[model samples]
Target: MEEGICYLTLNRPQRLNAMDPSLLEGLLEGLQGAAAEGARVVAIEGVGRAFSAGADLVEFYRA
Candidate 1:
C-alpha cells in the first residue's frame, strides 16, 4: 500500500476503461490480493478521463 491506501487502476483508457471479462477478472484478483495483503482500504481508479462507459458492448454483439 502507498501512503496507507491500496489503489486499483483501470488500464484500458483507449476503450474508456470498458469492462471485459479479463478486466473484470483482474479486478477481482486485485481485490483479493489487496485483502490478502491486509489492505484496510481499496480504491478503484481509471487511468483516463472516463471511469468506464460500462460493459463492452462489442463482446455482447459477438455472442
Candidate 2:
C-alpha cells in the first residue's frame, strides 16, 4: 500500500497481463490486504502497452 492506500498492478506484459483465474485471486488478495490494513483507497495500474487485453491469446494458443 502507498500512502496508506492499496496499489495493485498486473504483472503480465507479453499478454498485456490479461486477467485469468489467477489474476482474480491476486486482485482479491490485494483488496483483502488493503481492507485488512484499513487502507483509505485503492489504485490499479498496468505496466505494459495496454491496461489489459482482457484475455490472453498466447495462453489460449498454448493450451
Clashing pairs in 2: 12-17
Please give, for residues 1-63, the per-residue lDDT of candidate 1 as tens digits: 886578999999999999988889999999999988888899999989999889988976776
* lDDT of candidate 2 over 1-63, digit per residue (tens): 768888889887777879776776788998998999999998888888978778665566775
Runs with alpha carbons beyond 4 Å of true place in candidate 2: 56-63
**Residue 33 C-alpha lDDT in model 1:** 91
* TM-score between model 1 and native: 0.86
Clashing residue pairs for model 1: none
Lowest summed lDDT across 10 adjacent residues in model 2 is found at 54-63
